[model samples]
Target: MNKWKIILDYFLKFLTALILIFLTLIIIFKFTIFNKNYIKNNLKENNYYEKVYDSIKENMENYIISSGFSENILDNIYTNKDVEIAINNYIDIIFSNKKDKIDLSKIENKINSNIDEYIKDQEIKILDKDSITSLVDDLLKIYTNEIELYNMFDNYINLFSKLQTILNIALICLLIITIILIIVLIKLKIQNLGIIPFTSSLMLLYIRFLIYNNIDYKNILIITDNFSNCLVQIVTKIVDLILICGIILGVMGLIAIILDSRKKNKKKE
Candidate 1:
């Protein structure tokens, strides 16, 4: 009876931990994927730079109606403030989704290398001291926030590649442990084997589904910092959940192994 109690207690722990892990997986789907779909559908498939361009155009149009542009004003001649705000949004939206994750160094190099020369050309085109001075003020603000902007992508890369990997190892170990525990309970004939593994198997299957279906980065563009931000968040969350669940299962496996070992030594006595 005491042995049966031990197995029942183990079954209870496995069920509770599995439930907690499952809930976190739901959070991953809701926050990372569902929200991404929501934003994409509402915004349409336009590039975020395109979106920012449209926003600035609309703002300029309203300004023109209320006021006016200078005679030499060029089309797309955004002020420093406009440029700063647009660039910031570009970074934000990109980082929000999780897809095609790469290391931060590589991503930053690709984006910065592509953009710097273009910005340099833009800098040379400014015709006056007022433009330069105003640009400096706006840029200072933009650069200060630049780290936060880059950090969104950085966090996602680590989360998806490293953190999720660790979690996956954990889940695998847990599942293995759970299996051993179950076999022990059964071999010992310690009452019911319980419903934990049945439910856990379902979760593992679903996680594999998300990982397979969510890799379409072509639909999403990482044209700016904002776009990078969105991509990292969504992708990392999904992968991380897979890892967390894997870890939980692995823990259960370890528990089973330990219990089995204890039971074996008792038999030897």
Candidate 2:
């Protein structure tokens, strides 16, 4: 090959490898991170009962300890099973349905109604609207925070929507360019097709190593237990898919090398 052709060949090979890795990543993130249906289905499958239940229980206990309610009243209120039941129902509703907007007013009203029933059952005479408001406000703090987080995620998804068209176009163009590069390599009598899958596998292995070594799940859990659990679930699914793809590509690369070797031997014979 002439100097210019040789340089062009090397550059195309490098570009092909880079595009292979990028294409794999784009596909993975597109399906897992940006796909709303996938996220919703995964959370539904996990149920999130333990994470949501424990966080709610702990935060409410802390709130009750710091509040101005009398010890006897607080003790009676905390001991009631309805608090746990209400929290579970709240979480269930939020996760089980795909709603555009979360109306805290509706949630507050339902909680107030539940509190009224609880007071009627306990025959507590001293608990007026002010006291009830204090208790409900304290309890709703966690729910409100959760709603805010949901809104943040909703905004994130919206941003993804704006970028989706651009991403799709780039993905398609990259795929076509990658295929053309591979075909050109073949026409130039360069056995470089295996490099695409080999580079893909290497990229996935690097990502897997980073995930295993760099993440601090403990700190995440400490900061926000429920959100951390959800994050872990999503990361786990992504890692699993990466591992599967890596293994498949690695195997294909090996098979291609073996076949290439066999073909060369047959020509010599």
Candidate 3:
């Protein structure tokens, strides 16, 4: 009977450790990847909006050169602020799970006005109204595509929404179960409560180590160089956050164990 009770205590500790591991993962995700604001903050930190504006201008220059128009015609058509607004709007749509298209009316109008002025000033007769309209359309398309990045986030929005809900529910359930397990373990006179947190901390650290070593996140190439840079920065930030949280938990567990040991030593004395 004593052996059976010992086994049950160990089993309960093991379950608590598993729950803590999961809880740590959910908490990390909740504050990092799954949070829309976290992504937006990363984008801002990485100067993503400015890089996007430059990429758009560069792409537009290619179309302008092919269309036999002076690249100067692309100047002042849009600003970094415009790019920021469009990108933020798209991000909001993705997070909100909306199917709305990004509004490019301001960019279109600005491009059309620039083209009209360029043609009128140069007195260029080779490019007619329809041809110039086509050029304007092509330029605006470049801006839109640069901002949307081929709709990479669209396919995952619904799935992410569902997963976020599930994670929240799982986190709450695990918290309750962990509390109950700890209470039961205490009632059973299990003194190694620190083992649960210590095990969980080790688990988190091992997971972080695996991800850092296995994934070549530094050289990750996405749609564009600017986007890829932003992705790398975000990924690095996430990894660092994981490391910090793991260390914090490990320290907490160590302190708890030390305190438990001291108390046991005093009782023995």
**In lDDT terms, which candidate is top?**
3
Estimate, for each residue in 1-269, the C-alpha lDDT of model 2 and write its tens digit: 78998788677767786787778877987798656567656655665544455555566667767654333332333322433344444444444343444344645676666656656777777636787787787666765554344344443544555566667787899889887877788888775466667767877788777887897543455345556677788877787788887888778877777787888898899
Candidate 2 — which residues are off by over 4 angstroms?
A: 57-100, 115-138, 147-166, 186-189, 215-219
| 2 or 3, greater by TM-score | 3
Q: What's model 2's lDDT at 77?
A: 33
The lDDT for every candidate, in the order shown, is: 0.50, 0.64, 0.84
The root-mean-square deviation over C-alpha atoms between each candidate and the true structure, in angstroms, is 12.9, 5.6, 1.9
lDDT by residue (tens digit), candidate 1, 91-174: 344444444322234333433343345447556453465753453344333333342343545546444445445555665665
Could you tell me the lDDT of residue 4 within candidate 1?
72
lDDT comparison, 2 vs 3, better candidate: 3
Residue 253, model 1, lDDT = 54
Candidates ranked, most accurate by TM-score first: 3, 2, 1
On TM-score, the candidate that comes out on top is: 3
Candidate 3 C-alpha lDDT tens digits along 49-137 = 98888888888887787786688788788889888989999988877778899887877887777777877888978636788778778
How far residue 4's Cα lies from its native spot in candidate 1, in Å, is 5.1
Each prediction's TM-score against the native?
Answer: 0.35, 0.68, 0.92
- What ranking of all candidate models by lDDT puts the best one first? 3, 2, 1
